[model samples]
Target: TVDKYGDNSIKLGITNMLIGEYLHTIDNKKRLAVPAKLRDKIGKKAVITRGLDNCLFLYPLKEWEALAEKLSKLPVGQGDTRSFIRLMLAGASEVEMDSLGRILIPDYLKNYAELKKDIVIAGLYNRLEIWDKEKWSLYKENAGRNSEEIAEKLGELGVY
Candidate 1:
């Protein structure tokens, strides 16, 4: 089967699944070093944008393109949809890794996510989510406490 992009669906099945959580530091210049393992999957260029829960989402160029295509097709009449699309698209920035595999986070993005010196880079399948270390810690604690309830809800959705 071919997708709307004319690419074989089977080929799309072979996607890079980013996993694991890594701790790193954002230098004074606002650059964060992409983990060598994660860099291998994300390539040299990517799109970074504001994400839900006060984090930044980093998508490899190809993944970002696919997402953008779908988002573009959403009905503009719906206020929620329009706001969501604007939030993701308007906040997006193209970033290229430097020789040392570091990508600079714009000050605006850093401020939005409250990213300080300590940061957490969490790999979530097709994308990476960058979180402020303190915020991530608090979020993780809350999520862990609710894991059982969350799992039950997902089970209702046939996830389990």
Candidate 2:
């Protein structure tokens, strides 16, 4: 479905992917309203976790299960790998979306992301990244300025 933002999440028969940036707010109780366009794809149940770059990652149940499976197979002998696994798995919380399409953000995660009243829910394929509005704005500005350099690196990796 295309939202007012004109972003499309489904294409070519693929399922469970998302795309868009939605401006929303968390209430005094820390309940976040998931965009209707995204809630269906995200499913009634989701996983919320600490993500990199000080943002929270919200994943659909199926995707999170798949990711957990893959993460379980990584080399446990590597110290960094073990640490990374702990950071992800140990920090994850299974959340159920309410009838109003809301999910409660745990205090730890809210504090971790430094979330204020305003937020930007960015729909990244297979997950949503919740960022504080100001941080998202600054990060977008910096990333926009570096897009050419970033694309060059992706090109080197044969991904651009």
* Residues forming the 10-long window of minimal summed lDDT in candidate 1: 2-11
| Cα deviation of 12, candidate 1, in Å | 8.5
lDDT of 2 at 127: 92
* Clash pairs, model 2 backbone: none
Poorest lDDT segment (10 consecutive residues) of candidate 2: 3-12
**Candidate 2 lDDT, 32-77, residue by residue in tens:** 9999888878877889999988999999877798999999999999
Clashes of each: 0, 0
In model 2, the Cα lDDT at residue 5 comes to 26
TM-score of each: 0.90, 0.89
- For all candidates in order, the CA lDDT equals 0.89, 0.89
At residue 141, what lDDT does model 1 achieve?
A: 100
What is candidate 1's lDDT per residue for 6-125, written digit by digit as tens? 323232344557888999999988999998877767877889999999999999888899999999999999999999999899999999988899999998899999998999999998
Which candidate has the top score in TM-score?
A: 1
